[model samples]
Every structure is written in structure tokens, then in C-alpha cells.
Target: MNDIAKHPLAMDGKDPSNLRGDPIDPERYYSRSFMEKEWQQLWTRIWHIAGREQQLAEPGDFIVHDFMKESVIVVKQTDGSLKGFYNVCIHRSQRLVWQDNSQKSFACPYHGWVWGLDGVLEDCPDRGDFPQGDPVGKLKLSKVRVQTWGGMVWYTMDDEGPDLLTYLAPTAELYKNHQFERTVRVNWLRVALNTNWKFWSDNFNESYHTRTVHPQVPPIIDQDHFTSRYEMFPMGHNRIIQMGRPSLRDRLPDGVPHPFDDALRAWDIDPDSYPDFETKAMQGWLDLKAAKKKLWKEKGFLHYEHLDDEELTESPFQVLFPNVAIAPGADSFLVWRWEPHPTDPEKCYFDQWTMAYPIEGQAEFVNRTAVNPLRLVEAELDFREYDNGAGVQEYSDQVVFQDWQLTAGQTAGWRSRGYRDPYFAAQETRVRRFHEVLNDYIAGNPPGR
Candidate 1:
């Protein structure tokens, strides 16, 4: 057989590929030190998306997120600015906020010490009788670094990590002309799973698993035209290659509204309401053209092209390494950030947020326009469960539940004596590139460039 048939993703001078080989070493994964390093060195330093600006809409609104073992409280100040802090009370390390919502201020159930929305100490139980003479003035809730990007809240434990924009890099530009600041509906979580954080990310970085793991995703995306590319950024950050489906230029369903073309007519879309509709719609048109070219190259038929280019590019999926994955569709975008749990080897939190463009001008239509990418469309076949030689977990629920069992199963197998390192194929470049960065970080390579 030819080399292409024999070795998919073959590279020169590297060790033999690890395609369909032994599993990765479980010991490296289960090592206490590895987990601890992740907590101290990685988790604390990395910028992780916690929630969106809409979640902290009101001045006193706050959202409490449990990151690893760290409790993060994202609160909107009276000035309409947002701040993030460790949810622990400055006094006795007690949790300051139990739930997420608008409150005048955060009060510690432990000692009744309260902090303002800005995370400043604002009240104490009794100041006159204290032996330390009012420790309140000296103590304020410890603040964590926070920044908002693409209308989402992101934080880091280290005050010295890269700036939020710098950290997100080229990925941040993905939604540049889409008016993302106005689209802020999302659901996020910081799951605690025993498996390595990389496991979930690796699974997301490659589309090869889609056909088997996410049966529906494959039909939505053109797999035969698939190609995976990688770009390394400074500070050990990376972006992976995920192109639009070849069928994107295909004709839309008959009689559907041509939002892009309609805007150019005498009935112009209101700029105030549409914001960046022109740019976004133009992008959709261009994407549709790219999609049509892709389909014609691989498939011998002409697909519908009524939609704009922006619609074309916005519907595909891509991954931004270390944490975020973007799965965009016609109706909405699914954004996920994976966080390592504080104290569990068997657990990590997966925070997923969904963003949809609000149908402009019509207030009532806004709510109706909000879309969720993961919501199961009733018409499709849902083989929601997978058997990995273990008892099943749930029935036709969602692809996520399906992956939960497999990821957890892989975590369990990591400890097996027969387990060995995986040999990756060239087609699995994204996975291998991810591991390269992961190993480099673990090995204490000098950062920058």
C-alpha cells in the first residue's frame, strides 16, 4: 500500500506514529504532583472563561463559579463594572456567597462580615469591641484578575498572566465583525472529573472522533474535505485548524428569508438594530462562496447559495487550545471552557456557554432568537449512549453524556498496567500538537515565543 494509505499523518524525523496503539500512561495522569502542579502552576495562571457579561447585568448582580476547589465570585459593581474575587471570606476562609444573583453586597455567614460589590470591606458585625481594633479596615475580599472578552467574563488566579486580549490572540478575532458584545446568552460549569484536562480538549480538537462519538456533528460538517492545521502562539498557547464544511455554499431551503440580500434593497436593515449586520452578513456571503467552492471540488453537485457568506463561516466549528472550543451553527454558537477541579483526580468541570444573535429591533423576537447549539432537534436519530465494555450511563440524551462515560472510562484505563502511550497519526496533528504543548509545560520549558 502507498504511504498515504499506510501512515495517515506521517511526519519526518519524529518517533513512529501512535495511531491505534496502546493507551497513554495512567501513572502520569494519576500523579498527585501532576494534579497539584496543574492547580498551582497551570489553573492559577491560565485565563478561563467563567460566564458572560449578561449574567452580571445589574450593578449588584453576581455569579458564583466553583473552579477546581476555588470559589470565584463575579460581581457587578455599582459603577456597572465587573470584578472577580475569591468567594472565600477574608476573615476565616468561609465561603462568602452561596448562590448567584443580585445582592446589595456579599455577607459572610461565618462572621457576618460583608464586602461591597467592588470587593471592599464595607461592614463588620461589631467594630467597637474588637481586640484587634476593627480588623475590617485591614481586610477586604481578595480579588482575582478578571477581564471581559466577546461579552464573556474571564479570570485568572495569577495577577501576572498575559492580558486577556493577548491570551486569546487570533481566536478572539473569530467573532470580530459579528457584534458579539450584544449577544450574551450562555450556560457554563467548572466540572470536576478525575481525567486529565487534556483528555477532553484532545477529544474536541479532532473531528475524527465525530463520526463515531458525535454522529450528528459529522452530517452537519463535511468530513471528507476535512483538514487539520496548527498555529503556535507565544506563551505556549495554540490554535488548531478546523475549516468550514464544503456544503456551506449549498442552496438554502426554498422560500427562506434571504436576510443578507434583502438588506441591500430599498428596505435597508436598520443599522441601529442590526449593529454590524452589514459586515456579518457580508462575511456570511463570502463563507457561502468558499463553501460552494469546497463542495464543487469534492462533490459533483451544486448546493444552495441563497445565504450570505457570514452565515457560511459562522456555522462551522473550531478549537482554541488549552480551554475553549467553538461549535457554531446556523442558529447559535456553543462555547466551552474546561477547568480542572481543585481537589479531585476523577473530576474536572466543563463550562459550556451558548450565544445566539438576538433578532434585532423586535424586542419580543429577542428571546425567541436565542439559540442553543446542543439542544437536540427532535427529528434526528439520537444514539445517545456508548458501550465501552462497561455498564451504560444514559439513553439518547446528548453527545456530552455519551462522552462522559468514555472520558471517565479512559481515565480509569490510565491506571491499567497494560496501558501504554498512544501513537498518533498525521491526521491527528491537532491531538499531537496539543500534547507537545502540554508536555513542554509539564517539563518546565521557558515561556515566551
Candidate 2:
């Protein structure tokens, strides 16, 4: 791994001594009161991703991001800037937009109030009937702080919260090489799961379960704890950088085709030339980096020009505080965001977006987490209920599908009388740290606030 020590904000996420050893209470995962506290203290104060900036390329394009009971609309302005407003009509409390699309102006369906692209009220019915004077030019949609970063549109409900870049901290600086704006979201999917949203935050904080739940990952991305580097930030986010090669601990049975072999051959390295499994896993990884460095431009992988050696062949999975995780690799970027359901504490929505750089001739991109091949274009939203694994049967091969299968059992375990404080592995230190941060937020002491 590169010298993370050079990054002043990076701390050893695997060290238990860095954490407060807070007991992860079971109630926080399933209790309505605890969920309400999170809604008031944590969710409202934090920045949220509305959608990709690519979705609002034109002046009047907009995207609606509904979180729990609140909804926000981020629109592209005529001045080539982005603006966000609470998705509610000024006259009445009706929602302004039902979905994401382009429009010349926002027309409230219940009333004839028309809000301009700039959010000012352009026209309204019964102009002379208002006792408080006409609301046409005087009334405007309530605004939220909007900003764009990494090709994403973000807004925060708390007017006093830290700015988007500051809240993200070193993470924003860490991934500066990635041209996220250049990639297209090939797969945009949201699945309703029968579990609390924190399940994803906990699941993504550690790779200890990958060996048991996602057996195929070790062959493609080394999951062995000793071979990986873990770093935690003071701002509550954490990341794990794993080797992008087959793990010596997880060797396939003799004569079975290795996925790493295909990766090596694609980069013009001969896997058979390594003479041994250990050599192929270690030295072959180094050779693959060299091959990419030498062949990237010729292969039309222009996006790799700014990538360093580590970014070229390693996988760094980042958990952005409470509920976002992203694996930004050389060829593809996989992002996951989990949001709490409006009323039910046990139900949550999980969004998965698979984005890929547009290589010259590649017509399709297959994300590492799933086998489904997606066309290389911006995809429309596809939403479904997990329905105990029946609604999303087409995505059964996905790693997230396997995780979703465990949600019900885990949810039950959390409520069990036998359940207590988690006996966490050293590698799972980030998991407990996440709870500590949540505790801080509920206690009115959120980090970076």
C-alpha cells in the first residue's frame, strides 16, 4: 500500500485503542425512538447525495431525492449553477415534483402556482384573493445549501452544518484523480429491504464477512486481513485498501480457472510464467501494475492517466460515515447508499449505482459485485421490493443479494434476548467506531460540526 502516513488525517482504523469501545446497543438498529433521534440529530445534519450532476446537464433538468419524510429537489439553473429546494409548494404543503425529469418550470398539480427554474414564483391563481398581498414575485421556494463534488449533487437540511467538502474531508482530496463526471451510471437500482439502514453501515465497515459470505471476492480482490491496510479519519469515515490480486490463503482447487489469471492475461502478463501460486499472487500483481502503466493510453483508458501505482491495481473501499460506501477502481466505480424508511424502522431503501469510464470500444460494463452486464449509458431508476428475495430474482448472483438474504436473520438476531454487545474482531474496529459516532451525534456533539 502507498504511505498513508503521508496523509496527516489518516489514522489506523484497525487499532481498537483508537475507538471508545462503545457498546453497540440493539435498540438503535430497530427501535422507533432511536430512529427518531437519528432523524432529528444525524440525518438532518449530514449532507445527502441527491443524484449525479450528469443527470442535470441541461438548464431546467432536476432530480428529486426523498429521504424519510423529507424530500429535496436539485435543479439546474439557467445561470449554469445548481440550486436545491425543499420539494414542497409554497402555497400549500403539497409536494412539488413526483419524480426526476426536465421541465421549463415547476407547476403545482393541486394549484396553478408555477415556480420558475430559479425557484421564484412566476405565476399563481387567485392573485387578488390573498389577504397577505400577492405571492407571485414575493413568494419563493425554500432553499437548501447545494453543492457539487465528484459528479454528485449534495444538500444538507441543517443550515449550520459543515460544507460538503469539509464534511467529506481527506476523502475528497484522496480521490481527486478520479474523473467521476466522465463516467456514466450504467445501473441505478433501489431495493426495499426488510432491515434497518445501519446494517449496510456495519456490513461495509469490515471485510471479515467476505470470506464467508462473498467467497468469490478473495480471488479477485484479496480479503485477507493481514494483506490489507485500514485507515480511519477523525471525521468518522473509514476505508480499507486491499490488494487487487488472488489471496494466497484462498487458492482455488487445482485446475479450476482463476479469475486473476484472466486479469493478468488481459494486461499481457502470463499467469503460467509465475511458476508458483505465491509468485503469481505477489510478483504478478506488481507486473500487472507495470503493464497497466505502459499500456493504458494505447488501450484508450484515458481515465488512468492521473492514477498512481496503488490506485492502478489496488481496491480501496471507503465508508463515508453513516450510510455511503464506494469502491472506486481503475475501470469501474460501485456506490451504495442506504436510507431509512419513512415510518418503519425495520424497512429501508438501498441504492446501488454502477458507473464506468467510457473506453473507446467497450459497449457494456460488468460491475465486480454482480454478473449482470449493463449497457454503457445512463440508466433510469429501477425500484423494487426485496419481497423475501422474490422481487429481485434476476440479481441473485450479486454479492449484495447474498447480503440481503442475511438481513432478515440479522434483524431477528438483533432483537433476540441472547444478543448483547458485539464481540468485534480487530479488523471490525470500524464497526464499533461507527456506533460511537452515532452516539456523538445523538448527544449533540457530532464530529466536524
Candidate 3:
């Protein structure tokens, strides 16, 4: 039995009739004019993730999120609330802060103008020289709307747009079982990719490409489309939940060691207890869930207490509107965000944050997407330019690294003169639905108005 919710506000994501039959124009991927449309029509209207709630534990802690050409600072207020401000100083538009740090007040380096944690201008260097009547308490930074959910800090430029939870819809409600607040991010990485930002939006909308692009995943995540569940929310977000078992059609060779066995072993289930491979793949999955339910608390996985049977062993990937995709698995969570470049439409930045729950006495975890063992602690950000695969050499074994290798070729493919509208598979219905929603936003008729 699957745990896919038929939300009242969501459409049948597997049905192509739900889409507008919109042609995904190639220009939308790499044209400057199209990029300008996204900036004016979509970017300003959507809620953006600045950072995490854990980063703002103190009253004055702040995260400076620099997106394309715009900069924003989400600060923790003295009253224990969160507020966001455009990072530009009210005077001369100088940048207020360039990094994430804790401070009682922000002093602009341009003219030593001091701004309080609440965004009020506390002091100006030249008190008497201002022609606009000293401009201290009366002047303040421009405010942006800020909210938090799922341990993530969110902000929006459109002051009147829907709240974060409303924008997230059933997607937010579906993931209530996860204690993301207690999870520690082990890998904070950003890579400058050569492909457009929409690449990730499309790439994550379907499991069709996973068998080809990420071969190793089929054995662990059950990449068969028929076995997966797809959902499309009215707010432009999408979700796909695949069972935590090996795909029968994509089985390994006889001598090859299976990843599913390792997963079963981790939960105290004997892999060799099954008589056959098919029984091990099907019956073993149910047994694995039962084993986890029986051993979670004593095994130090307190977060599993509230999780349902499906939540304890399923792989649910959520695509949040236009740019963010997240996998809130039982043991690990991954947030994948991609944004356009400052000036070039052919390039984008990809952020990968790997978070794992803290199990008592467990210092390390098996990060399926990473090469190294992930420790249960927060990690500092590591930024790199792809440089045609020369950079991030240490992440060669990571699944995302394999995806990164396709950017150079995919960029060239998009600009091909022979390019035409894509003919998608049934499993890829959400890909077309994604572009249809983009059409809605660009047409000023976004869903969930």
C-alpha cells in the first residue's frame, strides 16, 4: 500500500490533461530577454529560502542570501522574531553585509551608517551634514516579508503574495512527520553550473531519467515509474514518492552486492533470511519497516517515533515551485536549489545541502549521494566553479557529480538550431506540467492566486 495523499488542492500529476500543453520554448533556457521576464514576472513573486532556522538561534544572527544581482539579509530580532531586509543601505545603496554572522547592529562600510537588527537606522557618520534632516531614526532599510517552516527560513519580495505554508500547500502538510528542525546539515556546497536553472526543475520532476542518469539509484530507491507516486499541488510545487526497495526490472548481476541488503542489515533484518531475490525485494521491504518500528527508539532514532510506516521507509522528493527540490527521507534530507546567474542566462548556481538526523552515539552516516562519511554536525559552505569538472574533484563519487558532468553538453544541446519541443514520456508528465505553471506565472495568472 502507498501513502500518496489525494489532496483537495492538488491535481493528478500523472495526467497530462492537467497541463496547458504549453511548448517549453528553448529561448526560456538561454535567452537574455526571457531571463528578464523571469526576473520581473516570477522571481519577485516567489518565496525564497535565505537559510535555516538553526543559523538564527540567537537574537542578532543573520544570513545574507545573494541571489543573482539582489542581496537580502534575514536577521533574528531581539523579540525572537525573524525579519528580512534588502541588503542595500538606504543611503547610496551600498551593500550592508556580505556574509552570514551575528551582530547587534550592521554598520555599512561605505559611510559607516549603522543599522539596527530591526532595520532601523541607528546612526549616521555625519549627523549634521545630511540635507535630508540627519536621516537617523526616521530612515530605515526596506523590509521584505519573512517566515519559517520545516526548519528553513523563507522570504518573499512580494509583500502581498501567499504565506510560505500556503505557497507550499499539501507538500508542507505531507512532510509534517519529519523532524527537520533536529537534523544537522553535513554538507553545505554550491557549484557554479553551466546549464540553466530550469534544468534542475525539469530534471527533478520525473524519475524517468534516474535509471539512465543515476544508475546506482534504481537498486536502492526503486526507480520504476509504475511503482512511484506523483503529485502536483495548485501552488506549482510537485512531489514524487518512490518505494524504498530495489526495482525488479533493474536488478544487479548475480555476483554483485546489493545496496538493499545493506539497508536491511542497518535495520537489524537479516538479508539472507529470504529464500529468493523477489521475496527479498518485496517481503523484505515490509519486514524492514517492521524491524525499524520495533528497534527505532532503542537504536537511538527517536525521530522515527512519530513516523508512519511509509514515512519510515519511503523516498519522497519534493519540487518546490520553480527552483528548489528536496528529498525528506527517513534518515537523511537533501535540499537542492538552483538560481540563474547574475548576467548570463546559460549559467546557474546549484546549492546542495545534506542534512542528517542526530542519532545518539551515532557519529557518522551513510550518505548515498556523497563520497565521504557524513558526521552529525553543521558544516560551513563550500563554493566552487565547475571549471569543466576540474573543480570538485573530491566529489567524483557523488551522484550529483555525475549530473554536473552533463551541464556542459546539455548547455550546447539547448542552443542547437535543430532543437524542438520535447516529446515526454508518461512518467515525465510533471515536466510538462512544470513548464505550464511557469507559463502561468509569466502570464501573470499564477496558481493559488
Candidate 1's displacement at residue 254, Å, is 21
Those runs of model 1 whose alpha carbons end farther than 4 Å from true positions after fitting are 1-24, 130-133, 136-138, 184-195, 225-232, 235-311, 314-316, 328-330, 360-398, 443-449
What would the per-residue lDDT of candidate 3 be over residues 257-375, giving only the tens digit for each residue? Answer: 99999989988889999998889999999998999999998898899988998899989898998999999999888899999999999999999999899988988877977647977
Q: How do all models score by TM-score?
A: 0.70, 0.97, 0.97
**C-alpha lDDT score of every prediction, in listed order:** 0.56, 0.91, 0.89
Worst 10 residues of 1 by lDDT: 1-10
Better of 1 and 2 by TM-score: 2
Q: How many backbone overlaps does candidate 2 show?
A: 0
Pairs clashing in candidate 3? none
lDDT of 2 by residue, 199-287 (tens): 99999999999999999889999988887899888888999999899988999998999999999998889999988899999999999
| Runs in model 2 lying further than 4 Å from the true structure | 1-6
lDDT value, candidate 1, whole model: 0.56
lDDT of 2: 0.91
Ranking by TM-score: 2, 3, 1
